[model samples]
Target: MMKLYKKYQSLIKISFFIIIFLISNNCNSQNKYEILKSKIENISQNSTDNSKSSIEIIEFLSYMCHHCTAIENILNQWQSSIPADVILIKIPICSNKKSEVLQKLYLTINEINKPYLHCELFHMFAKEKKSITHIKDLNDWLISKNINVKEFLELYNSFYIQSKSNRANQLAKLCRIKGIPTFVVGGKYTTSPAIAGDEYECTINTINYLIEKIRKE
Candidate 1:
C-alpha cells in the first residue's frame, strides 16, 4: 500500500512539474512575439515622410563592411524578390583608395557573363576573410579561373573603371554617406534599416511602408 501511495505521489509530482514547464515555455514564446511586435510597431511609427521624395530606394553598401554584409546576407534575397515596379538599387560605398577595385569587379562580372563570380568573391572576402582589398589580389584570384592577368590589369586601369569609380565616389559624397548598410528612400532621406528596426522583417516593413507612402502621393 505504501509503495502504491509513493508511486501516486511520484506521478502527481511529475504532472505538476510538466504543467509548470509547459507554462514557462508558453510565456517565453509569448514574450518573444511581443518583442517582435513592438519592434514592428516602432518601425511603423518611424517611417519616412515619403510625400516629398521623387526617387527610389537605394541601399548604400560596402563589401568590406561587415555590417553591410550581415544585412545583405539576411535581406538580399528578399530585396531581390521585390517586384519590378519597386525601384531598388545597391550603391557601393566609395573610398579614394579602393573604390576602383569594386567597380572593376562589378563591371567585369557583368561584361564577362560571370555574375556568379561576384557572389563567390563576396563569399571569399566577406565570409572567408580573404585579402581582397588590393587590385592584385583580385587579379590573382581571377587568374586562377583562367582569366588573363594582363586583361585584368588593363581593365583595372582602364577609363571604364576609373570613370565609374569616380562617379560612385561623387555619388557617395553627394549623399553625405558616413556609414555602410544605410538606406536612402527617394534620394532625400537616409535611414539605417537595422537601427530603425529590430529584425529583418521590421527593416523590410519600414521599407515597404515608405514605398507605399511615396506611391500614394
Candidate 2:
C-alpha cells in the first residue's frame, strides 16, 4: 500500500509539470505575435472619412519598392481568405514620377477582373527590372498579355481612376507615410514589416490582432 501511494503521488506530480509545460508553450506561441501601440498610429480625419465601414485597411505602397513587392506576394495568398467585413484598399505612394503612373495603373487594373496580373506586374517591375515609366510602356505590356491596350489606357487616364489616385495620395499624407508597404488598419492603426521584423506572417498576424481589437471596440 505504501509503494502504491508513492507511485500515485509521482504520477500526479508528473501530470502537473506536463500541464504547466503545455501552458507555457501555448503562451510563448501567442506572444510570437504582438501589437505594438507605438508602431500603430492614427492618420488625419480627412484620410479616414471615406472609411465608413467598421473595419477598413489601407496599404500604402509603391510599385518600385521591393518590400512592397514582398508584401504583395504575401497578400496574394492571404487576401482571398480574409474576413468579409474587412475592406482592403491598395493605395500607391506617389512620391515620384514613376509612382504616379504606377498608382494610376493599380486603380485602373483593379477595375478589371484580372487578378493574376496584379502580382505579375509587380514581378515585372521588381524581378524583371522592367522600367514601366510611362503610359506607352504600360500599354505595350498589356498588349502582350492579350489585354486591350486602348481600353486600358482610356481607363487608366480616366477621370474616375484619377480621382481614386488623388484621394489615395491625400490619405497617404495623413498616415505620415515615409515608406512603402505600410498597412493602416481601421484607418487608425498602422503596421509594417519594419515594425514587425522580417516575418511577413507575423506582420499579418499583428494586423489580424488589430482587426480583433477593433471588432471588440
Top candidate on TM-score is: 2
Residue 97 of model 2, lDDT score: 76
Which portions of model 1 show Cα errors greater than 4 Å? 1-55
Write candidate 1's Cα lDDT for 14-71 as tens digits.
Answer: 9999998975554331122111111110111113533222346677776676766667
Each model's TM-score, in the order given?
0.65, 0.73
lDDT of 1 at 75: 66
Q: List the residue pairs that clash in candidate 2.
A: none
C-alpha local distance difference test of each model: 0.61, 0.75
Backbone clashes, candidate 1: 0
TM-score of candidate 2 to 2 decimals? 0.73
Candidate 1 at 37: error in angstroms? 31
Per-residue CA lDDT of model 2 for 21-117, tens digit only, reads 9755543323443232443333334445544554777788877888888878778677788876676777776877777988888778778878677
Taking all chains together, the TM-score of candidate 1 against the true structure is 0.65
C-alpha lDDT of candidate 2 relative to the true structure? 0.75
Per-residue error at 179 for model 1, in Å? 0.6
